[model samples]
Target chain A: LAKTTQPISMDSYEGQEVNITCSHNNIATNDYITWYQQFPSQGPRFIIQGYKTKVTNEVASLFIPADRKSSTLSLPRVSLSDTAVYYCLVFSGNTPLVFGKGTRLSVIA
Target chain B: DAMVIQNPRYQVTQFGKPVTLSCSQTLNHNVMYWYQQKSSQAPKLLFHYYDKDFNNEADTPDNFQSRRPNTSFCFLDIRSPGLGDAAMYLCATSRATGGYGYTFGSGTRLTVV
Candidate 1:
């Protein structure tokens, strides 16, 4: 499994755009970058996933470079409820999804 | 809705006692995973069952065990609950093909006292 690295914490104001980046230098050829949001006492919720370039969903957007070594999760117009730990996982069918020390995004008022 | 469900959202067990956490999924996914999450820590994979085949993580302790009966139900058995074992136990399901992310249950908060 590919190991992922992310910021320990980030602070963002409400209505601002927050971008959290993850680095997976050893990503595999078939790996996909997927991001998840986890609130207090709740399971991680899928935000967005992408293999390359970009992928957007109703909740967030994922941008991956051509090398696929890094990916970014962009949350637009954040609110206080968006404050949570965000995890970036790199995995394929053959590998289990392993979580790193996620980025705790705090959406400040 | 078709989703992963964990029973007894909260559980309190005596120290050295045994406790079981249950998870059921309606999605009919081929993979079922168990994870343990402590305070302010990332979720740690305990084990998983792909169909009837059970896979255990190399680092998982002997105190932790899991059983999957049929396709919809899976159980986590903690042989001896210690104070350190008090944490949130999360159950998730995913398809064998990957791409799609795992669907997680709300998690069962276990308190060992």
Candidate 2:
């Protein structure tokens, strides 16, 4: 399983765009990058996923470089409710999703 | 909406006692997973069942066991509970072949007394 490293925590003001980057230098060729958002006392929810380049959704955008060593999750126009812990995971077929110490984002009004 | 559901959102268990947590899914997903999440910590995989095949994480303790009777229901059985076992247990489901994201339940908060 590939390990991931992310910032321990980050703070952003409401209406600002927040980008959380994850480094997985040992990422494998078949590994896909996925981001999950978890609020207090709630389960982690899928935000976005991508294998390479940029993949945008209604909720967030995932940017993966050609090397696939790193990926960024971009949240546009953040709100107070967006405060949560975000996890970056890398997994392939039949591989269990291993979670690392996620990035805790604090959104302030 | 099709979703994963965990019964008994809150449970209080006695130390050294056996307890079971139940998870049922309406999505009919082929894979079901159990995860333990402590306060301020990342969720750890305990075990998962791909159809009828059970896969346990190497780091997971022997006291933690699971059962998947069919496609929709899976159970987490703790043979002997300890104070350290008290945490939020989350159940998630995903398709077996697509390698897509998991759909997680709200989680069952277990307290050991």
Candidate 3:
């Protein structure tokens, strides 16, 4: 399993774009970067995933560089409801995932 | 819509008492996972069942056991609940190894008294 590093917390205003970056220098060849958003008392929700380059979804976008050592999750036009703990995971075949503390994004008014 | 479902939503148990938390999925996914999430912490994987084969995490305690009667149902048994064991237990499922789009249940909040 690959370990990920992210900011402990971030503060952003509503209607602003928030980008959370994760670094996994030891990412393996078959590893895919996945992001999840978890609200208080709720299970983590899948936001976006990408192997390389950029992938966009109805909720968020994931950008991965050629190096594959790092990835970023971009949330557009944030609202107070967007405040949550964002996790970046390096997923591989059948391996149990390990989540770090994650980046807690606080969308302030 | 098809989804993962956790029963009771909340549970209160006495210290040192045994309790069971259950999960069922209508998605019919091949893999079922159990995770423990404490307040302000990340979800920790306890174990998972792929079909009938159970996989336990290296650091999981013996007190925490799981049983999967079939594909649709999985249960987590805490042999003796402790105050420290109070947390949210989440159940999830995936189609296969290296699978995406995992479906997670709302979870059961366990409170140890």
**DockQ for every prediction shown:** 0.67, 0.65, 0.69
TM-score winner, 1 or 3: 3
lDDT string for model 2 (B3-44, tens) is 999988999999999999999999989899999999999999
Measured with DockQ on alpha carbons, how good is candidate 3?
0.69
Which candidate gets the maximum lDDT versus the true structure?
2
Please give each candidate's TM-score.
Answer: 0.97, 0.98, 0.98
Worst 10 residues of 3 chain B by lDDT: B95-104
Runs with alpha carbons beyond 4 Å of true place in candidate 3: none
CA lDDT scores, all candidates in order:
0.92, 0.93, 0.92
CAPRI category for model 2: medium
Per-residue accuracy of model 3 over A1-109 as CA lDDT, tens digit each: 7789999999999999999999999999998888988998888887888899999999999999999999999999999999999999998987756778899999999
Least well predicted 10-residue stretch by lDDT in candidate 2 chain B: B94-103
Fnat, model 2, is 0.57
Chain B TM-scores of the candidates: 0.97, 0.96, 0.98
> Candidates ranked by lDDT, best first?
2, 1, 3
**Model 2 CA deviation exceeding 4 Å by range:** B97-99
Grade the docking of candidate 3: medium
**Model 3 TM-score on a 0 to 1 scale:** 0.98
